[model samples]
Every structure is written in C-alpha cells, then in structure tokens.
Target: MTSEAEGRFHIVDVSSITSGSQRATLRTDDGVRIEAVYEPYTRGVTDTAVVLAHGFTGSADRPSVRRAAKALAEHAAVVTFSFRGHGRSGGRSTVGDREVLDLAAAVRWARERGHARVVTVGFSMGGSIVLRHAALERDTGGHTDAVAAISAPARWYYRGTPSMRRVHWVITHPMGRLVGRYGLGTRIDNRDWDPVPLSPVEAVPMIAPTPLLIVHGDRDPYFPVDHPRMLAAAGECELWLERGMGHAENAVGEELLGRLGDWLTRR
Candidate 1:
C-alpha cells in the first residue's frame, strides 16, 4: 500500500527524523511492498547511502540506534527500512533467508536514486540478513561499498550448545517453543529463519573484499563471543570486538560510534 502523502513520499514526524525523512516502498520479487526510509544528505553528498536494518522482533525505527541513521545521513544518504512484516513493510517474515530479498529491494532503491556507493548496517538478526543479502548484491553486479553487522549470529541452528540453549529457552520460553513445534516456516521470530542453506559462518567467507565488518560485544549473551571470532577466523572480513560490550548495547557506545565512523570513512 502507498502512503497518503503526495507522490508516495511522506515525512515521518518522529524524533528519528531530526533533519528530514522521506518514505519509499519497493515491491520485492515476491510481490511484497517493502517500506524504506530515505535519509539523504542535505549537503549534496548523495553518492553514498547506508541501508540500515533492525533485528528480529524489532521495528524499522528501532529505538536501539535510530540515531545512527541520522549520524550516517550527515555523511551520505542512508536508507533505514524494514523486512517484510517487521514494520510498515508488507508480507510475512521468512526468517533472514527470504528477508535477503528485502535487503536487495532496498539496495536497488538506493541505486535507482543515483547512489553509486552503498553499505548495509544491520542490528542483531538484521545483521544476519545483511550478510546473506550482501552475497546476492555482489552476485547481481551491484556495488556495495561495505557491510557491517552488530551482534550477529554466525549460526541460527542453535540446537546443542549448552549456554546457547539456555538463553534460547529464556527468550523463547513462552513462545519460541510453540513456533518451533509447529514447524513454522522461518518466520521472523523463528530462530531458524533462513538457515542460509549454508551456515551463516559459511556466508561470512564470501563477505570480504566487499568490505565486511563484524561488530560484536565481548560478552554477548545470546550468541557466544566465540561465534564472532569463529566468524572472523573463517572469513577475510574485519572482526571488531567491543570491549565490555554486549549485543545491541554496543550500537550506542562512544567507541562503537567512533569505530563505525572510521570504518565508513575508509575506502
């Protein structure tokens, strides 16, 4: 569905839009209307764009680090949008696999707008989504300057690791089991969503040279700290560990902000 505003462009009247915000909807290959926020730089620096995505059970305007969008727009154009069913975007979530299409849709949107250089910044589950989609972006002959993921899991098949299982039970204790029991086909809440056909770790190896940065907390409870290390070890990408940081919390830290800024500034 299109927005009510003129020309399908509506300004979001939220704090998230400090300077300004414009809306656009991309129709995915699966016929889903994916909603995206176009945060263009006001200084005519339109060549660069960052596609920001949120974690599972998170919103397009994820309160976690919405400011990052505003921060990035000052540098380049940024697009912070939702996966299907996660926010204003339409359709059901197919875990992170099918959601790759959502990321591709947003990338295409940026490219069409004359953004020759684009990067993706995903939070949590969104991290995994960005990783999966980055490969597709490369395969399609698109230009993705960089890809960064925060607190991402290298493997969602979290079945046997003792600590992994415990926390998994806590988060999904009330509802996750039910979703799993029904064999729910890789929905957003389903941890097994979009198992990557190959492990997420396997996907990591392909992210390098395209400029992949894996940002993880030293003490992320959801996924083991070693997971990111394993990811780093398996791939040629940069693994940036945030000391005393855990998962989404790192997004708001000064160190993270600085590192992110530096990374963006790099070629």
Candidate 2:
C-alpha cells in the first residue's frame, strides 16, 4: 500500500484503540492541507477501505458525515476527509473542479494505510468529485476500486430546480458568498472555471471496468431523477433510486447506509 504519496501524510493523532480511529493531516498534490480521520471496521476484519466524501459545505467533522462513516465502518474501514476550504482544511473551494486533488490525496492515504481495496462514496458535490477522481486519477496512484455517487449532478451549471438555482446564486454572488462564509462556514472561491472541468456525466464513461453505483433520491430538490439516469446510462452502472430519500448526507438513513455498506463490501 505504500507509495511516494505516503510521505505527505502526517499523523496528528496516534491513539489507536479498538476502533483504530485516528486523526491526520494530508497534503494534496497541489499542496493544500486537508484534515482526515480514519476509522477501522467496527465488527469484523476486512482489507477494503471506504473513502467517504462529503457534500458541499460538509466536512470531516460534520455530524452527518461522521454518522455515515460510522455506519459504513461496519463493512470495512472508512476514511473521511474535509475537502479544501471546508472545516479545518486550507485553500478555497473551487466547487468540484480542483477537488479531485483532495480526493486523490485521501485515496492515496487510504492505500498507504494498508487497505487492499479502496472504494469511494460521495454525496452531492462530493459525488461529482468521486466520479471525476475515479476517471482522472485512474493512472495515478490514487485509483479507486469502486465508486458510489449519491445526489450528484449530471452536468455543470444546472439550475433546473429551485434549490439548485439558489445554489448557483450562492456560488456566483458576493452576498451569497458572504452568507456562505458567515452562515454556512464555507469559503468559496470567487474565480469561475476558466475551462470548466469534466462534468459527472462526462466523467462516468471514463470509469469503465471499475464498478460504479449511482444513488439518487426520487424527491431530491437539488438534482432530479434525470441526473442519476444520465449517469447510469453513460457508465452502464448500477442505479439505486431510493423511494423516500431526499438528498445527500442529510437524507441518508441507517437502512440506506447499511445497503451502501453491503454494496461496497460485495464490490
């Protein structure tokens, strides 16, 4: 599991009890500092590691993210990290564009921890990141064995829903950015994508042979069912349309988490 990237990880906490949970700081390839936590399997022994990526404004220490990680730990070890600009991480959020580097750093860290297989599970903005990371980092040491994207957008600049429209305002307006910073505790970069990075739909096809799962809620307000449908069609992957689910980490429940854990285990 060791690689050159392993040198970039600096463990800040080493108190490994039965949970094998520890805190560390990771340096992305681009040099952004990221906060991460590693939690070992809760029940049984397994070599697989699940790298959990949280949605926009969410961080490694978020309650929802922590719960999801704990639930998934029942199947295998889980690695959760705060994307740059969120939580205690350094750098501004480029939305989903450069976030791939953050995920790549986390994946590399998971591998360095001696995991035989690494599975990436993302929610919302994180979902988009995992798809793009799985595609773009395939050749790099950050490759993921499997991927699951939940409540992700198929395309960029999508304002189809009111929630998404508000999101656009939050990303594009100064006042919205102020609210995001003070109210949401999320610092967003003011620069627009000079050349828009790969969209989730476009990235999905490139993740072939690597198992992919598209999970979306039928009643999601940010992205409609068509988003997941587009991803499934492009990648020809497994699609799970949760009936009553709403969106992202907030909507995820124990049952769905268990199912996701099972999917990661079987993969």
Candidate 3:
C-alpha cells in the first residue's frame, strides 16, 4: 500500500480495479487507521451509498461481509470497513464504544465520494454502533440518511445468553483478550467502558424522522426476539423478525440482503 497524507486523515491506496472497486486505508478522527473497500453499484445506477459495518471479529475482507457488500452493491454503492483492531486496521478495539468515530469517518468519506444519500447497515456489535452513531452524531457530519441494524442488542451488558457471557469474558479478561487477538484475529481493549456510553435502546428513540430498520433472527443464539422488539418499541421504525435466521453476517442470505437493499433504496 502507498500512503499519502490528507489533512487529519491518511489514505493508503491498495488497488483500483476496473470493476469500480477500490481499497484504501481510512484514518478516523480519533486517529485509528481503518481498512476499507468501496464497490460501486453493479446492477443499476443509483446515488445512494451503503456503509456496511460488520460484527465483532469481522473485517471488510471476511467472506460473509464481502458477500453482503456484493449483494448490497447490486442496488447501490457499498463501503465496507474494518473496525479498529480488526484485519489491517490499526489500534485496539473498544468493542462498540469509540467505534462510533470509526463509522463517522466512513460516513464522511461516503459523502465526500459523491453519494447523495448514505445509509448505514450494521450487524451485531456493528448494529449497536450504527444505532448509537445515528443518534449521537445526527448533528455531526456523520449523520446518515437511514440506518439498519441486524442482530443487535437493545441494551448494554446483556448476559442472558451464553454467547453474551463468553463475549463478556473476552472483553474483561486478559487471557480472553489474548484468545481474541490470536485465535479470532481480533485485538480487544483491556479496559472497561468508563461512565458507559449511550445504549442502543436509548439511541433508538432519538433516531426518529430518520428512517430506521431493525432486523433480528427469531432463532438468534446471541440475543432473543426481545432485543429487536425493544428497539422497535423505542423507535418509529420497521422491524423484521427473520424466521430461522441465526445471527449477524453468517446468517444473512441473498434473499434477505436483496430485501435490505430494496429497503435502503426506498429511503
């Protein structure tokens, strides 16, 4: 990659393929270098851009994320990026806390790239980030035209499920952090969330007037149907309880992706 300084952010150009796809390094306002890929629409012409955020341990290059990006790109331009500490990105993961800045950087980049409308679609940890970012950064340049969160938790520190319990251990224990780093290729932050950031349930209420969609699987192993129900109750939005779906990107099928693309296009 060739790096070039651009004001407060840095960009490392990887490749610009003929398919209108390109890869680059994006520097968040917090100074974290994020690895990102942009894929232009393949099926039709559109002014919308979808900024796709992956779940924990996922990066832009991950197969599931790539599949979703390719599917969404059929409707509009797509931008997929690694949260800090994942893939080729620099810095440690804050889980979902400071990751807002990372999403903000991506949204800003999307606007600068000439997309008239920008939508944020996130899964799992990313789902919460998109919820919080849409609410907290509404006045900021990071504001998105619409938002969609798949398989997100409604509240914070939920340990009702076994998966969440293990997640907590990974975030709170040193050994688990090591496992996250080496075993999962994810580097987690050692510290806890001080003062606690705004939770997704609270953020949902603030996203009114801006279109919001909450998608959750009825068979989600991480969080039950109550999660999406809580979010929908808090916000005036659409809720889709995906039958038989599991969790996050892994469970997303082409049909669901196509429906999500159609929804974003309408907004």
Candidate 4:
C-alpha cells in the first residue's frame, strides 16, 4: 500500500477483451513489475475484496485463473495478478520466496481501492505464498482480513511423490529451466535459499485469530494429505479435504470456486 505505479496495457489481445474489468501493471515495493487485473464485485455485495495468487507457471490471463476470478466476483471484488517471473512481469522467480512481495502488492491495492475487508486466496505455490504473506503482513502491523490456502505444501524440499520429484527436476535442472523459460514461459532462479524462509506450517501460527481456511485434495500427486493436515494443525483452522481432487487450479471446479467465494463473503 505504501508505493506503486499504475501501468497501462501492454498486450492488445488482453486490452481488447470485453469484460467489465480493469487491467493494470503493479510495481512491487521491491521494484518488480506485476501484471494484474481487477474486477469489481456486483453492486449489492458488501465491501469485501478477494485477491488471488496463481500457481507456478500460471498467469493472470490463464483460463483457470480467470475462471476462479469470475466465480469469486459474484460475491466480492476480485484482484488476480501474475507473480513476477511467471507472466509479463519483470523478475526471476525464487519460487515462493520473493513472491510474497507480489501478493503483498496486490493486497495493498485492494485496501487502497477502499475495500474494508480483504481476503487472500492462493493456489499451489501461490497458496504457500498467501500463508506466508499474511503472516508477514501481520508481523509488520498490516491488515489481512482472511486467507484461503488451497493445495499448498506445508514444508519445502519435499519429493516424496514422483510428480513432485519431476517438478523438482523441472525447477532445479538446467535443461528444465531452459524448457521452463521457453516452453512454459516460466523463469526460475538457480540459486538456493541462503537463509531458509518460513515454511508454510511455520508461517501459519502467526496468522492467528485472522480467518484462515486450508483446503487440499486427498488425491493430489504433488502433495499428500499430510501437507494439509500439518497446516491445519499449525494454523488451527478449518480444513476442507476433497475426495478426488488432483492439484492446484486445475483440480478446482467452478462449483468449489463459488463456495470459496461464499466462504470469504461470510467471513
């Protein structure tokens, strides 16, 4: 909320879209450019806003992100932004480390726009960032009304599952980063965390008394049920476990998205 520069449209296709939404580029306090879109909630709703953070390799324009945003917009204003390095933003990704700054910037934007209450909802890597961001924001005396973290990992360096191992390879291997940069449009950092950042479970304790919802799927290949259990225990919040849900945004259906929007509205 302290400092940000509004940016104009850089892509014609996105600019030509006919939705009743506002698009702008946001500058993070650390100086990263974040591509974002804001969709005001329907008139009769209360003054609450939801900020969405997408998973790794996903952007604000992704169909899944837009779908979730549209669903949430039925109840509250929605702000969806691509984390630096993932979309048209300028910066290499440290995975979830500096991404917290991206979420913080978006949350501040929501507050600045006159939303009395702000709820952060994140998916996958984004989910972890939301948990950490809310905790970090509160530690600095900032306000975050509520948070919903879905399909997030409790701890880092987990490779118990084969899919996760492959993802690790994609993120850590040289050729993988090449493919990520070119093929997937994702730029990942090749450096290690010198001073380890707070794990998702570690960050949960600090978000106390602020509403928190932990949602995970039993069938997620990236993370087992234990991840959500660990977060639920640490945060002492409600956990919604879907029976056959897979992972992140892909696994999220429209019905669930609406329910999550309702959940945030009620909070």
lDDT of 4 by residue, 100-218 (tens): 98888788778777788889999999999999998889844235788999999999999999988888987999999998899889999999987889999999999988899999999
In candidate 3 the C-alpha lDDT for residue 21 amounts to 73
Off by over 4 Å in 4: 1-15, 43-45, 139-142
Off by over 4 Å in 2: 1-6, 14-19
TM-score of 4: 0.92
Query: What's the lDDT for residue 186 in model 2?
Result: 88
Listed per candidate, the RMSD to the true structure in angstroms reads 4.6, 3.1, 1.8, 3.5
Q: How would you encode candidate 3's per-residue C-alpha lDDT over 42-158 as one tens digit per residue?
A: 976778999999999999889999899989988999999999999989899999999999999888888877898999999999999999999998888889999999999999989
| TM-scores of all predicted structures | 0.80, 0.95, 0.95, 0.92
Error of 3 at 20 (Å): 2.2
Model 1 has an lDDT value of: 0.70
Best by lDDT: 2
Candidate 2's clash total is 0
Backbone steric clashes in candidate 1, count: 0
What shift in Å separates residue 259 of candidate 2 from its native position after superposition? 0.9
Clashes of each: 0, 0, 0, 0
